[model samples]
Target: MSAAPHIPVLLRPLLTACAPVRGTWVDGTFGAGGYARGLIEAGAAKVIGIDRDPLAHRMAEEWLPGFHGTIVLREGTFSELDRIAADAGAEQVAGVVLDLGISSMQIDIAERGFSFQKDAPLDMRMSQSGESARDIVNGADEGTLADILYLYGEERASRRIARAIVAARPVDTTLALAEIVARCLPRQKPGEKHPATRTFQALRIAVNDEYGELAQGLEAAERALAPGGLLAVVSFHSVEDRMVKRFLQLRAGRMGQGSRYAPLAEAEAPAFEAVTKKAIEPDAEELASNPRARSAKLRVARRTAAPAGRVSEQEIGMPILNTSRTTGGGRPRR
Candidate 1:
């Protein structure tokens, strides 16, 4: 038999919201089949699993038989959840769970190029095929790199990091990039994390177009979920968490409807209810076991019985800055 699926963080809360009883559920990330296994254990009739990573797809094929529920694994991004769910004959899915972040398996595998601590090719694409992080690092201009770090990684020293990266061109491996970033910043005296951690995060986010996928995925989930269905998203960083938080808030009719006093036509309520007023973080036990869980925040919302509504492509309303390169002055990394 295949190895056990990694234990998902916040599994109890996710299962509580999802309540996977005898109905179809979607495990959008399917990272190491953790949440999917839980759904099966909770007595789901069938589980439709989707992942962008080919490695994850292979894992699902190998390990899904261990679960009780019928499993269907698809090699695709969650952004296409509607199509995938429909194609699987899973219209109006009872639940959809998205665990947003790199899987532990991916980080453990050095060839995937996700962990900064490892020495491997600078590739961070979630899909098996895509432009790698090495391409972006070597090709992007200082401005473009800085914007990526700032917007995605929320790094305040984006400009400094960008300048350092551009100066040290053709950073081919994880360690090379990490070392450059570490050198640019002051050495951590003790009990401090690597300075390149944020830089690696920014690069991975850019390489995978994570936020973009998430925006589309949220819309797809809204469309695919059945009335009263649950939509739970676990985000590991601010960028992903912000997207989930805003998406749910917008769906719950909190995104300032146009012109309250202009005699607007009576419109139906949106097709979702906020399950949790605020995002939920992992508990002490989960954090103790997996330090990665410390950064994870889970937000769940239930689909309303109303007809589905059109969601704007620009759900977040923040300007998605163009990722093109620019010729700009460099700053020293501090």
Candidate 2:
């Protein structure tokens, strides 16, 4: 199937924040190559486009060659973006751009199982390998399912929905699971989102280990970027946005002490400076062109000269769950 055309969310603001975008840059989540193309067109000497999904590479084959080696397409996760950049002959990149969440291509494809709007096999693996949503739905215990729904999707009726899922075991299709979840919630009103939306989001996040990857990817960007390098991330949901916001704040030395009663501890040298103190959202024109950009937010920061360091998962509010049984799923081992 031909890939759907994608409008890269927050592209305008991202380019503006990282202006004079010379030198090598890494498009960490290079879905549809939108950000990579934008970077190259906006003055980046080279763009290393990295994506875990094989479909992304396949789609790029048709158009990436036209760039004449300005854009190097690599099939890999952004969690190891530093390694990917170094292997591509760039030890330190000038910028890193990550668009968090599923790409339009994946969501629009019914067989990929990212959307509940279509009935297809329950597969949500971005890499097209490892445990799929079907495995988690059929194998995970009620408690694990509930935790995933609650922590990842922020669904208030996680337990109830999980119970319904358990009762309908061997659910192997996207619409089947969507129906089960919807049965547990109220009917959707005219403007309200579908009842199954949160459940589908939770399953997809678990199947792809998206939260874990996001945390590791941020650190990888920190290590890969040269001093004064830019890190621009566009997140589609609150959980993802909060994690990015907090990570940037902590790295920029904007984190506050516990309370007035507690003594202020010595702060480390800031590793980054905020390019945008607040998250940038799509303007009215962009929103009108693409309603999917409604929930998207862009946060940009510039790297300082300080050495790269580790960040605690708790500080970034990463969702924690026991994913030991699921192959290739869970937080990166420190």
Candidate 3:
């Protein structure tokens, strides 16, 4: 089997925050089985690993058998944790870790079409079971496509990039998209980042519905955790990190608004206590060793006895973008 691609970002902090001794733990993303393997190695009684990617499921099945703890790998999104936990007979998970965004394996594999650097097909679905990137770029309206790039990638030149993309209709390849995007930006300096990077990121996030999944997954994690349970997440971009930060702040009653003298109406007991006031970034050593670790930010929170809102597994299936799937070289209505 191929070696696991993920480096398991924020391992020490995640384990420390979760602190699983003998209870059940969940690795929601289970990319490369890194977090699951780490939790098991750290002495959890049982570890349940879940991923939407069928490839990840197969990899875990092949690799996690001889791990120290009892390992159970399931195939599904983290937003469906309730079903995963129920099926595994785990009453309450003591710890849950979600390493958000695509794993290194996906980016490194050129055929997955996750990176702008490599020439590959334009297919970026994480589950490998949905509409491909080709379906979106080649089908979606220019405005809808531009909005996705701006919101997901935080790219300032989104309109120009989207215009270029639309002008080049029936763009069926990764390099084709990347080259078009590159044309919209200034010529790169020797050490400057690739202009197509953000555009590719935007496409990947839209293709995978990653941020949407994260929101649902975070809410699900809160619901699935027992009192005093932990939820740990590592995000590689600002959009995700902001969500994690805001969610924790809102849950912990840490949002700075009114004064203590003002009597505030009692809300549901805060569901989480933020373990890291600010998200943690990798150290110099880690950053130097793995450049992919550069953008990663880890946020962790412990569950309170307080009630949390419910999130359904079906919610993840909702359409986030207005794009249509077209097959005959015609634009699909937004």
Candidate 4:
């Protein structure tokens, strides 16, 4: 509503990769409706925009009306996108676009507590209702916290950071928890990301169950698309990009063999044909204009007539925490 502060990363590359973007499309992470609006303007007859965040729907009230009925906003996660599309009279959409990870809009707002830069409450719930960072930071066992940081954020100093976090009990604010994390590692240098970056990213991912949602959502997109329909995903980190890349590559039968868990199963036809043999990155112009686009990578594929198939969590390289992830203040056993 406030003029789309978030820029749709890799828009030009994504659009160019998905040229002739006609028919109904699904913008799964419809942060500020930038991708939805872009699709509609590029040629989509209608776009069923879906986002788990209620804030997105509320913020869209002012601008969505202007698009008339071309843009329909839905309050739900992309994991249920197939059902949402079916219910919206789009049983098989022409395309699906998912921008993975936290939205810039969420990080920009001080109260969201997504950014380590701001001194806000440690609340980083994407849906605005759930166990927040404060709950995890002040509660989760040291081992659990370590696993989360290591697996989710790929932080090497996860154990040390987790130890510090558990020692500094009752960390209430973003900056407070950040300070504790920063102390566990070397100080930040000029041009280097803050020491708390990985820790914060890990907590956000765990709190939101992003990797799990991503796996399910990818399968859901596979189910929701018609033959020849396009699927475009833009990821900001190595782990997420790896998951997307592996999912598409495996589904396209380019993984050289079937998933280890399903190696004995009958040969299934490739469900998708890779459109972009390699991931598309943002141009220098876009990166210069929006520094946030620096890490963005886009991958596009076209659905085939093959039945929607399953890909094991292991096949896509999704990081799985062996320990329990339930929210609590339980102390870690030695």
Q: Name the candidate that leads on lDDT.
A: 2
lDDT score, candidate 3: 0.77
159-249 in candidate 2: lDDT tens per residue?
9998999899989999899899888998878999989898889988988889989999999999999999999999999999999999999
Model 3 TM-score (2 dp): 0.88
lDDT of each residue in 202-305, candidate 4, tens digit only:
98887787888889999999999999999999999999999999999889888776467867556689999999989888888998989999999999999999
Q: What is model 4's C-alpha RMSD? A: 3.4
Worst 10 residues of 3 by lDDT: 325-334
Residue 207 lDDT in candidate 3: 73
Q: How does each model score on TM-score?
A: 0.90, 0.96, 0.88, 0.94
- Model-by-model lDDT, in order? 0.79, 0.91, 0.77, 0.88
lDDT of 1 by residue, 1-334 (tens): 2233376989887777656455888999987887877887798888899988878877666667766448888888898998899999988898899998788888888888888766889988888676888888888788888897787677788899889999989789999999888877888779787888888887787777676677788989989999888899998877677678777777787776567667655656877888888888888888887776887888989999877666553666432646434221111111
Q: Rank the candidates by TM-score, best first.
A: 2, 4, 1, 3
**Candidate no. 2 TM-score:** 0.96
Q: State which candidate, 1 or 4, has the greater lDDT.
A: 4
lDDT of 3 by residue, 42-93 (tens): 8888889888887787766666768644888888889788668878988678
Off by over 4 Å in 1: 1-5, 66-69, 258-268, 313-319, 324-334
